[model samples]
Target: MKRRVLIGLFGFNLLRQSSAHHQQHCLSFLPNPIKHCTSIRQSLPQGAMPNNVDARTMFSHIIKASKLRIISILMDNPCAEVIVVPVLSDNYAYILVDPDSKESLCVDPAEPRIVLEAAAERNVRLSAAFCTHKHHDHSGGNMELQRLLPGVEVYGSCYESVPGVTKGLSDGEIVKFGNLEIRCVKAACHTVGHMLYYVTNPGNPELQPILFTGDTVFIAGCGRFFEGSADMMVDIMRMLRGYRKDTLVYCGHEYTLRNLEFAKTVDPSDSVMSKLSWTERVLSMNMPTVPSTLEEVCTFVSSPTNSTLRFLISFQEFQYNPFMRAGDLKDAVNATSEVEAMAMLRSMKNRF
Candidate 1:
């Protein structure tokens, strides 16, 4: 048997492969030939494809090098499986796997049945579950997952009462599922007990670190300040912006297009505008635009006026995301303080 995977800008078109001797009657790119991920493929009409799949679908298959990018090169029989299972409109529930041990964990699986079936598809059992926050959509499936997978380790924040958290984790706490070690980072503003999980594989250095940021952050925007003030957001943003430039980011929802669209209104620089166009192409293929590196989104430019505020703008190449430029926006809203700048930006974003 021979196997060949096509690597493109978006990721691999494993379903659209061919051999020199014969065109392997490969699976139709399901919904769209350009890029149709497994999850999105489930929604297509029984045996038919969609309309936008072919017509002007050039950019849809492109994984924008300027924005989010998937790790495909070093993924041959990798340590963990980052199975993205799309659920409930725009939410992404993940099933993480350690192939050697057959050990698996789920992140923010709000819908139990969908996640359980996704796990079944991979023939992996859920040994544990981590909820990024208490949001109903992120942790709603907790109790049921516990019911289905008895003795599963359910971890949540020490600050909130998560649905079925068998153990409560706090800032800096570390936990493991097989060879994957997850570091808990406390997040503020979106929710008091909001948490972000950072996973590291010491066994495989080539495999980049990954972060599960519930609603604390998005591709181009941070979460709305619901439970805290702008001051609190500044702290959270400061911490997240300092993450390793190579770290991969996965947020809760599919808000890349909307966030980038709003970001263009803030900077309108080639970076943001170009990313917006790229994201539009990604969604056109019904493909997900995620797993963006910290380097692509730590897009901030410091303000000369604010000497007290401290923010490390790591990726100067993409100094575009408005929320990342809190200090730089102080002058826009006549804000004398960094917190004031953040508040004004949030207000405008909510209305945008």
Candidate 2:
């Protein structure tokens, strides 16, 4: 009798598995495009997707047909949302999704496996990848991801050697994916040919604009002057000021703690600087320090007065006293000969 009972239970589970598999296959037929730009639904108008979607929708039909019983027994909570994976020790590669149509968009992918695993877990179809800049950490994963998902659109400012660049994006060009319309803004201060993507979904205006600044800007600090000038950065800041104060700014790198510390040394009296100490500590714990605001940029580091040119000691006016104003510093630097500037920078760095 015990043997018979065991056989019956095993047979029951097999039947349940078959039923679940069939249900999942039926869900696939309900319109889930293998790529993001292609809408799965037949009836909806163009471009309707979210920046993120709960994972349940990926396998909802199967869980429903099984009445959530067998799945609950086999897996963790059925209502648990998908986990957004972090990669490269700092970069957050995300799959922006539209569940109704099963369309998806990939943003700044830094690792192929991390993104592939998440998409496989949710059965999400990846559409295109929007690259913010040419920095390797930001664009390196595109080649491998494209191999896994063929014909995926890689959109960004024209890079001479970037792989999978089906569309060469330029400043002010707007690209659409589901409900999101992303405007590519030329924000090239960190690199010679960098751009930022300003993402907004009209359906939810309250969500605010999402600015992918790449290495051009950071939370408390901005990118180092690599291939661009302070004048160019100031111009970019002026253009960025057009966005609302609450726009969410996502930048490349995880350098908030270090940046805030550096900012404090520059502008100690600023209230924004005083308040960001806690922000630094939070980031030090290996958390994301981005999605900051444009208001914070003005308050913290994004103004003409804080121009990187002024920060470059060789370019700054040498002041006899610590309390000397930036104007005085600028004058002093301008007054110095090239030899004097070099000597001053060496001495200051040694002291600094």
Candidate 3:
């Protein structure tokens, strides 16, 4: 009895989890979605083999099956797609797959059993697990996942310890995942080791840049400064504000509606109103509103001076997130600096 192995080489390269509680989970498996990417993937590729192929004969059929159906699959779809796995109530962890090479990685595998099962179903290997912070919901499954996925690289911040961080990263450091270039940013507000991973694919312009803000920044809101001060958060916002305008933000928690409500309580700008309406629509469909563009987050809707250009340019120079635009906020108008304004704003949010 022999096995036949078929390896499909799509263009050049080929291919690329964990488990947790039995909560209400949703699997969003996007396969090189043109609408989605126009964002990220992580790993190399391995094609699916024929059903009749036996274990021993599988290796023998590799070269023969190299030009099979995967070619058409890859040819039709050349960009990467993210598999959004909802874990632990409203928390989200992502799996980005590189189309050329099936190399993939998971972000915040809260439950190794659940995460690994999802990845196995997709035929993608877990090359790495990236932990944004040391929180139980985010990095609690690190050691377990490491045990499940032997030789897998687990990355975290160098400042504070993450649960099972094999690699301690610093700010401005670059990590390469196949074609994706990930830049580590140490945002030490939520937790001392709290970090953000920003990804950019220069090879594929079709995908937009991605920023994984783990409890540091959320859609229409920023996180409460637990370990750090308002000044520290202001600094983080100052640095992140400089990212590419089109960068898509994927945050840790699904707190958009609540954050939007808080935003209205503070500013109630046109952008906040529009964002409120949009968030409701997305939530109605039970979709995750994780990825908002950096441009949208940074630019708040302000009254336009030019009536004709109002439609084209509706955003003000201030940020949509009240904490991000503390200086421009009516609540914080009396504050001296952005740092002071941020402090005043967070104090208000803490009470609210």
Candidate 4:
């Protein structure tokens, strides 16, 4: 039996509106032969909520309000699946599979057994592995998985030493898997040789792009600077901000709640955080709080002043640290440059 999947109508509306708006004002830029796409909508129960009421409803409402266009569909009842396998406390390993072809790829597999079990259960053949960075928790299973699945292609950063890495990927390198094109971008900061993967369905613009951000970025929080500097992180954020607003981001960890807790301190009056807190409560009970849009992450990372205060409050343990006494961050506080602000934040986090 094919289970019906209820897709939020937000993305559809955005795409429709954008296409219409572009057609009117910017016809030349708009590509010819635009494809009209439709998705199966989950029927809303009659009288589910009064249309005029502004009361909070399901998390789907939040998504609807965001008005983001659909980038990709994860499930169509056995057609394809993005299976999230939780391993080693808060780490997440994802399996992207096309059920019809029995072809699959595992991303950031921390534990080989867990990833193997997930593919086995789905009856899919693992053909490739993608590692975002060299972190033990993210690439630890690469070697083992390669051994188990002979000839499995493992791709990782050209700058980093990834175990069992058969092909080293440089920035802007594209790897094709069926209809999906995965682009690797250098996103150093958390690690000196960190890489971020962006997967897109170029043949179908209606499909959403997916970003596999290792520890460089997370929900409501960025990763700690271990090998790179605050400058690198700032650059990474700017680069990420350039991506399509609707791109769905799949980060490496389940740290949304904790990150939001810190965010609350930074902007106590932010309504978005409040709404997100509710959604986190509901979703975290059963699933990982991820697949956040690029726009959503920008919302959290923007406003250097707010972020500075947030970090100060959250990292009070490092308030008296010597690094805090340095005048280097003074320019950052004045917003002289975003790099300085990010540097200050990273420095504080390091001491924390």
lDDT per residue as tens, model 2, 1-352: 1100000000011011124334211011122222332222211222221223222112211111122121101111111111234566666565555433457777777776567656665567787887777778888988888898888888878733455567888778888767667888876656766878777766555444667777776665556557765556556655665676656566676666665454345445444344464454334433344445555231221113323311111111011111113222344445243334323432342344
- All candidates: CA RMSD (Å): 13.2, 17.4, 12.9, 14.7
lDDT of 1 by residue, 1-352 (tens): 2112222223332232234754321111112233433332232233222333322111112222222222111222223557676766688888776644668898987876667766664467888899999889999989998888788888999998788889999999999778788999988689999999998776665555778888988878888887988999889877867776667677888898888787777677776776676667556755676656666433211122333221223222226567767898787768898888889989988999
lDDT of 4 by residue, 33-144 (tens): 2222223222222333234422111122122211222122121122234566666668878877542344689899777666776566545778899999998999888988
Q: Please report how far candidate 1 places residue 176 from its true position, in Å.
A: 1.7
Clashing pairs in 1: 9-63, 10-63
The prediction achieving the highest TM-score against the true structure is: 3
Provide the TM-score for each candidate, comma-separated.
0.72, 0.59, 0.73, 0.68
In model 3, the runs with Cα more than 4 Å from the true position are 1-23, 30-80, 204-207, 296-319, 330-333
Error of 4 at 156 (Å): 0.7
How many angstroms is residue 82 displaced in model 2 relative to the true structure, after the best TM-score fit? 12
Report lDDT per candidate: 0.66, 0.49, 0.66, 0.57
Model 3, 1-352: lDDT tens digits are 2112223321221222223633445455423312222111111122132233222220100111232222111111113446666777788888777655678999998877677767776578889988999889999989999899999999999888788999999988999899888889889888877889988766766445777887898887788787999889988888877886657678888998998788898888887877777677557645566567666332211122322211222121234678778767744447878788888888878887
lDDT of 2: 0.49
Give the runs in model 1 whose Cα sits over 4 Å from its true position.
1-79, 296-318
